[model samples]
Target: MWNHFDTNGTPRTNNNLEGYNLKLNIHLSIASADIFKLISKLKIEEVDASLKYFRSAKNEKPPTRNKLYVINDAILLNQKQG
Candidate 1:
């Protein structure tokens, strides 16, 4: 696990990927994971991080109907249906 050394000459671990490695280690510690389980967990965390960032940056609010927009959409939908 230790090949390269950090600037201090201490053998380094996965510090190259600081944030990600920390998260993966936490996941591994919490559960017994095979390679496939590890990959799946990483993928889910990646998506969760991406979505979290997206929502935070965009200030996304909870889904709610705009009454006027909903009514207009319903009218259009009814016309197509009938």
Candidate 2:
């Protein structure tokens, strides 16, 4: 098991993720979803969590995009070269 805390010293748990799953199940109870679609939904939710900090009522601009782009570019370049 991984044990780590956020910058504010709050411990992380699967409770939040479980809640998301529960809600998704409830919402899609009658629907049939494919593996790719489910994975895409989870990935979109992950991106939302990462962007929450940058999304504030007072903040006009978020600085996370450039950083994420740089990291993604490096990974892509590595994959291409290797």
Candidate 3:
């Protein structure tokens, strides 16, 4: 009724569809992870832009209060709200 091979040389259908499903799932999971990372990056950029806009709107001066707090990378921009 059936033909099968075992490790010793029997034949079988045990090399079946289950493994195919697992391979598909692994690929799909990796793609979804990439999408999630892209969304997070977009959100962070949006927040940063919003902060910069409102800070600029007020046209305030940078703190002459502490010279040490300055970061070299900081835009030295952004005014405070009235």
Candidate 4:
């Protein structure tokens, strides 16, 4: 009856991957990653940046935006300024 509540702990990361620095390091240089991995990684990074941009926007105009097109252009401005 309690089976549903029993813990089913699982490793969140691949331990066997520890010895693969050279191999995994390749993932760091997106060019080394295959199309699927590259797209996923880039999409994740973009989503993270977009979330931060909008969260920091906090319903107020980001100063970098300057004028119209602010919403669409803020990310470019932030990138250049950074």
Better of 2 and 4 by lDDT: 2
Against the reference, the lDDT scores of all candidates come to 0.66, 0.61, 0.48, 0.56
Task: Tell me the tens digit of each residue's lDDT in model 1 across 1-82.
Answer: 1222222323234544797778788878765668887889978988998997898799988467669756755565556556
lDDT of 1 at 54: 92
Q: Name the candidate, 3 or 4, with the larger lDDT value.
A: 4
Q: Model 4 reaches what TM-score against the true structure?
A: 0.34
Write model 4 residue lDDT over 1-82, tens digit each, in one string. 1232322333224644674555446666654567787678678768877987887879755446336444425544455556
Worst ten-residue run, lDDT, model 3? Answer: 73-82
Clashing pairs in 1: none
lDDT of 2 by residue, 1-82 (tens): 1123112223244666798789778755657877776787788778887677567655757555458556655565556556
* TM accuracy, model 3: 0.34
Off by over 4 Å in 4: 1-31, 59-82
* lDDT agreement of model 4 with the native: 0.56
Across 1-82, the per-residue lDDT of candidate 3 in tens digits comes to 1121112223223443677556545555664567766577667668976887787788866336334334411222222111
TM-score of each: 0.35, 0.35, 0.34, 0.34
Give the distance in Å from residue 70's predicted Cα in candidate 2 to where it truly belongs. 39
Off by over 4 Å in 1: 1-19, 30-33, 60-82
Model 1: C-alpha RMSD to truth?
21.8
